[model samples]
Target: MNIPKNHLWLWLPFVVVVCAGYFIIPSNTFVQELVAFGIMSLSISILSVFFKDWRIYSLVKVLGYVFLAFFAFVKLSFYNQYGVPISSSALYVIFETNSGEASDYLSNYFNGTTYLLLILLLWPIFFLLKGLFRKNKFQEKPLKRAFLYKLFLLLAALGCVFAIHKKFKTENIPYATLTTWDDYLTAKKQLKDALAIPTSKAFTKIESKDIPQTYVVVIGESTSRWHMQLYGYGRETNPKLTEIKEELVVMDSVITPHVHTITALEKILTLSNQENKAPSPNGSIIQLANMAGFTTYWLSNQKPVGLYESIPTIIGSAATHKRFMATDDYNYDIYDGALLPVLAEILKDKSASKKVIFVHLIGTHLRYEKRYPKMFEKFQTPSKDLKFQHEKAIIQTNRYDNAMLYNDYVIRALIEQLRRQDGYSYLAYFSDHGDEVYDTMDFLGHNEYHGTRPMFEVPLLFWFSEKYINEKGSIPKDIGNRKYSLIDFPHTFASLSTITFKGFDASKNVLDSTFVQRKRIIKDSLDYDKR
Candidate 1:
């Protein structure tokens, strides 16, 4: 029943390779990489046992270790540079990069830390090389014992496979990469088709006054009303917004239709709603604004492409002009405030009588501490009401709140910029979806499978200039208390901008006098309020 020491040593190199990635990869992807690499190494070790020749067996084992070590080293280097593992978004960036751009990226990212991490990760290769050169003979085992050992290895491999079967679609790197590529292709096709359909064809009977007005749609990411002081959170996470509380229409009961960015934004930015689950034939709000004779501008701090083909990116492409501050997902240096100068230039444009600007902020996303500057690290102390009082949870919650505080500054700055413009202007700010930073649960991110209240409870705020208020009439006193869903946001946005098209529903618009509250459905199944 005992295995030879020489045979046992075969697993050492693989283990070392796995440990390299284990140290750098995030906790979420840890188990997937562990199981995947574990199964591979075990299978290879078993296969190596069949090689009667020592040289061939050593070669196979060493080759397997080297192959895995190479990938591990690459992954570790990427993680060291980006603070994230090699993702589909990173891959897409690579695929799209020209020779010049690739050189630039290499020069920028391949710092001393990258080389240091790579050197550490590739150290396992030396172990494999030493074993390859060692004078060892392949010892043949007894027939029964050999069969039993093979059976045990096979059973172990099968068990690992069975355990990870359900998660294979999402957790496995190969599956995720393939699916993500397919999704990107599909989304690219959809985007191409969408762009082909003329604005006149997408929306019927577009009517606009062609007035000298400016509308700014500021979209926030992973921000929750549950953590914001403006929404009654105990922490002062929204000091700037609170200061201008009288001037803003802070809707209290707004929830996103979905917990994920792509799902929520696809519905929020288009006519697709609970009643109409299909892709909106009427195009996005950007297209609608374009048809209304408004010069559209999409200014964003977020990367153009996320893990998959970003629906927001596809929607944002419909704008008359677009400017993305952050080049890649890992570029955390670009804050939301970077969009201010671009917006200022757009606001100064006298070329268009009316302008519709969309500002997308990377607000309160994961790695919350990186979402803001050092000065915004105000919420260091954990709150008493935190569900989980552990160190990690407390730190995450504090970082999220600090990110929210910085988000307050960015939103206020956008509002002020819009106010300075000499026109009827209004700025609407809302998160694509909310994050769960251990508020009501012991979770730090949003997931559709384990849906929570904080995951869908987004912040929807509106700031209007005096000219906008005088022209469009004052916001209703009861508007803040209205139970609304972002699924019907396009209608509300259209109503606010006075842009109407065929089949436009006044009942769905929260700003309209006849606005009616409908059941807030999330994930196309659960009623959010009822849940």
Candidate 2:
């Protein structure tokens, strides 16, 4: 039944308002995810309207249908996990694809590329099918109501375009709200402060070269500290590490500075907060590591092209102003195994003196089903319907755990593999932040639990190979049973590599023999790490 004309106005405006509000509000914070979701929404609804034809059974047509269905499903899943940002679905591809497995991402690259290409190709076919094959059976003059609907939709489209332009416009982001001189000064000071302070200060790199100790700090993604058995969690999420209790030291109380990648990882790499972090032009960690005579490498499973990682990736790619240090970059999206080939190459030559490899794994990241190849998901529930909340969460969590199991295997392999190396070698694995994983407040993933300990808490492990312990010291016995954050990483590296670098907060070492001295440590404070 047709609605009354006046009623249509109310309902239509209501629809538009909801459409704008849901997509606009949250997109302000999580622009990428929200944009992806928005695209998925626009694409799916547009497809339904334009491609509901009889010939959708063709292979190309089936592909178009697949594009619509898959993007919608993934986009909906992300919205369910991280609340819709102005309702963006741009990260929909990210959701449907694998995440947080640092090493495995390299292997998944070609597949991801193929999938993206297929999506692009399918869209054109869909457009062609709509434009060429669509039959306009209504030959009569267009009804006023239909015209009005089109006009309203056009207006809505214009609104969406304007909002998007405003969001993406270079002048609007991160610095957009600074409308006054005071705002500019505040932002400038923040930038200067964040850059100037050292995340890890050292004595100075004047000492003569000793036995080179290469420390690889691997940061896992979305890995909840609570899920791992090593972190004193009840679950056997880390079977490989659990069996080898003697070699690894897991710091159960390790917390993150932030929950979102942009916030957490940036601080981790820089290790500076408002008080200490002077807004210098260089990235904090990269700058410090170079000064300490260590080459820094950031191999990430996270996509470098996106917003969450763009800043860090660029910093890692840039030439460091300090000593012979370059943030030699490796795109982690190309499957973790692909990086292995590179690692094998790096180790095969054994040319570098002291190396610091930042292997950022997409560890136990979610939607969970996509992280592990199908073979590893045998433990995942055999259910396609994702509407049931509990079942879906359990299934996805299980899948994520299985992926963790795989990472545990890889880590163990790296451990054992490094043991074969002829030099003093060390490997440490921690996470950027933790996931909620249906355990805390029954949330599905990270970013939702912003500023909470569970969101920041991660499994931190330090390993000094028997060779290192037998050679250098006893893996610093005091390093055990201490709470730490990414804030301490640069200092810890300086201590381990024996690099006497200046401008570091050496007094706050997690491994310090007298590290118990701390002031009132506030929870969820903006200075979780820097202070």
Candidate 3:
């Protein structure tokens, strides 16, 4: 065994690692990481003197570069998405997302700046590895003075760490990130396992009061009413819906409880309300309608492939019939119009006495270009007629309004199809949650921590066939003008389906005259009355 007497070159990897860590992480984290890396360097340098082979030293140098590069990449990506460092919540979202969601991000949100940042961060490490591997050998002999200098630097770093320790605690510096990842994965698995167990309980006390009919609930995605022409926006984004305004019952001042898809939909489909907000598996609108003897169908355009099933998928599984259009292709432009044909088939089936169909449309989720066909790209630029526009967000706003235009077509098509059916048909349309596509802020996606008002403000519309209106009497003239929250949806759906049970509350139903408007709550616990 030959040990190198001088080993100053061993300190180079430590310097690179510490410098890279400081740059990649947030400013608040730099001091703690610098101190940790300093201690690590001292331990490795002290132990390197006993090395038996020079090849081991070269291997260590290359591995150090790989570690630095990996850490930098993770930090950059996390910061870009969340505006904060990596944590348990961020890890949960990243690991739980399906492949389709991931593909959507890469194709749409992965811009040149992110790619350039990654390249800049990794280039130095690549250069170091290339040089080390080219020689096929590592520098083992280091000048004694250089070795002493490295030791002095470590001591200086330790002193600085002590100085900052009084001001900022170093509690989270050691393995918090890794622990958060592990905890998130474990919790997610437990949740998935829980949701997998069948929890649909038969309602012992339920009855149908009105004539059996086809009731359709069209759940849209990430569309705000602010972008729609039907809502008095300057853009002509809703040509179809606007033309048929006399036939539609457009609700006013409606907001969803949550800016997130799963959270908002769970409340909409279940007996969950603002006062008693708990995810109830057995009491979903689907279960109640099924208990009331209505044939249930769940038709969706969202991805059906993923390790962890989405809550919507879990709830949809209880339906009697299910059809999913895509197998995790989120980037491709398979328009929401595809669901219309499947819906045509469902409407064609006259075998059932009654039917309750849940049509989940991928309406205007991110990558707006993929949501609609090219023909719906009407608002590409600022028009001379429309006044409200921002240069920074105009292009994105155009794409979003274009998506809304496409949404208008698909929704109206569903309504027209139901009208053509020979029965007391009814339809309700509402978005899962509104998006922040340059509405009140220059932001694009949901922000759970500080969500904006436009993030909750959504559109809720209804279309009742002439037969149902004539039989059940006209829908309250003021039903469309009522201010309501998405939490009222389950009760309203019950009214639309005419399913009466112990869980039915007319006061919470938006369509009922007894309906009461209260302070809207968001993110489960925040009061949004003033916002």
Candidate 4:
């Protein structure tokens, strides 16, 4: 021990650990924010220190760099694919740039710059280690070094195994295909690179117009109209909205293009379908809005940094953008009320014209208690799992129902403010998808148990002020069965603006009157292609 410590070679392990922390802390936060991540990173780095083979050291460095580089690119690619430009400055503030934010932020915006920095730091180390070992600078028994090396190998091995298991293992699996290291390498690298390329750009140039008026699009998370009393549900989940029934157009049975907000919003703003990522912006909502004359913006509570941030492009196109804004408050951590005032202030400028703002809420995001203020915690069910306790599941459902109550109120304020504005007031509200809470033998939140992805069944509402509604014409008030999804979003808006463009893909647009039948977004991959 003393000899290894005295030798410069002994410090290699310490370097590995320090470097690991430097890479992770600046990029990804953990479940409990970054404190937990630091502990985990230190443990893995120490494992590296225990290994003594020069080749093994090289493998670790190369593998870590390869993995981290893919990670950074995936984050970056996802951000850009949205066809929106998320401001690097806003990311720095929300992320604390150097300090980093919570583990939760990674799902929200593009911040892969940190990972790129990490890859740069490790490249030199990789070369140095390779050089050090090739020179045979340390004299030691191969057996002893090999012994140290195997122990170190065990740590790296375990880390890889755990990650694979977490992602691939399912509760009901008798067996699942074990993905190879090569598969992970290929998958992530492709994900990152595919998005980075210009081929994925999905929006048209939107020119800023005369007179600034902000159009706020509040994208609610995990809310279905069936759960809302405002739409014909039995419960009183939307007492505020129901009270003002005259102002609401609660579109019932509005299915979303994708179950998740990431994919659904992509369809809404980009005007693309489930078939592709950017590379085409012709009929996208962002393109349509820009063409119709309006500034587009996206503010989220999710973190998509790097490749993942591409989803925000639905709101920020080449023609329209104010950059994406996120609070990094996932898990419903940000209060539903926080977005309203910020929007109100931004819209106050009288000189601005037809500004379209999209607010992606953390509304009803997991760990239900955290979704609302502490006072709301009183509504937690008697049992946490609620697996066997039907009573507790019902209670948890009630808590979520209460959150819906809060959402209705929050939205009411936003619409009222818009009504007071001096322009053509219209509000098109839609949930990316609905949440199960406790339905179908499952606990709160969306999951596969709800048949495919639970996040796809969202509630969509398009509200117009009295002046705008009367000036135009009213949609048929009959409660006839009409299916709607985000695919109709572009067509619906285009109907209002009446702009024609070749990029518009109406081959599947549901808003087209001739297409009386509504189609489900999810396809039956097997069993005869029926959805």
Q: Candidate 1 overall Cα lDDT vs. reference?
A: 0.75
The deviation in Å at residue 70 for candidate 1 is 13
lDDT of 4 by residue, 465-492 (tens): 6665665566554432466656557656
Across 1-531, the per-residue lDDT of candidate 1 in tens digits comes to 444466655565456546755676678877776766566556656666656555676677677656555655565676655455566654543454334335435643466766765676566666666666675433333323467777887787676566545654443444456767787677667655674232636688989886788899989988999999998898888888899899888899999998877778878988777777665454788889888888888888877654224667777877888888887554345577778888888888899889899888888876577788899888788788798999978888888888899999989988888878857989999999998788776666765655778988889988888987888689876778889999999888898888899878889887778988889898877788777
Model 4 is weakest, by summed lDDT over 10 consecutive residues, at 170-179
Candidate 2 lDDT over 1-531, as tens digits, reads: 232222122122223224433553354544454453354344333333322233442233344445444443333333333455212112212232324432333332223433543354344444444524543332122223365665665666666556646564322211222233344355434544444333323234434245576666676777777666676655566777878878776665677666666456556666455345433443455555555566566666555544223444544543221111212222221234344555544555556676666676656665355556555554555333233457656676677667676667667766666667757778888787777655645545555323455677777787787767786566455465566666656666666666554455556667656565343232334444454
Q: What is the C-alpha lDDT of each candidate?
A: 0.75, 0.52, 0.70, 0.51
The regions of model 3 sitting more than 4 angstroms off are 1-68, 76-82, 85-87, 106-116, 131-199, 202-204, 272-283, 306-308, 383-392
Q: How many backbone clashes does candidate 1 have?
A: 0
Residue runs of model 2 more than 4 Å from their true location after superposition: 1-210, 274-278, 306-309, 319-335, 381-389, 448-453, 476-479, 516-531
Candidate 3 lDDT by residue in tens digits, 1-531: 223322444455446545554555567866655555455455445444433344565566556545544554555555555556555544455555676677756754565656866676566655555544444323544324355655775676565456445532332222445566677666445434434333345345677964568989999998888788878888788888888888788897899988777668767876666777544333577777777888889899988665236777767766778888867466777688888999999889878868999999889987787888887877776655433465746777778888988899998888889988957988999998887776665566665644777688899988889988888777765567677888878778877777777756788888777888877887667788865
Model 1, 318: alpha-carbon shift in Å?
1.6
What lDDT is obtained when candidate 4 is compared to the true structure? 0.51
| C-alpha lDDT (0 to 100) for residue 85 of candidate 1 | 54
Once fitted onto the true fold, the runs of candidate 4 whose alpha carbons sit more than 4 angstroms away are 1-214, 274-283, 303-310, 313-326, 374-395, 448-454, 503-515, 523-531
Tell how far residue 267 is off in model 3, in angstroms.
2.9
Q: Sort by lDDT, best first: what order? A: 1, 3, 2, 4
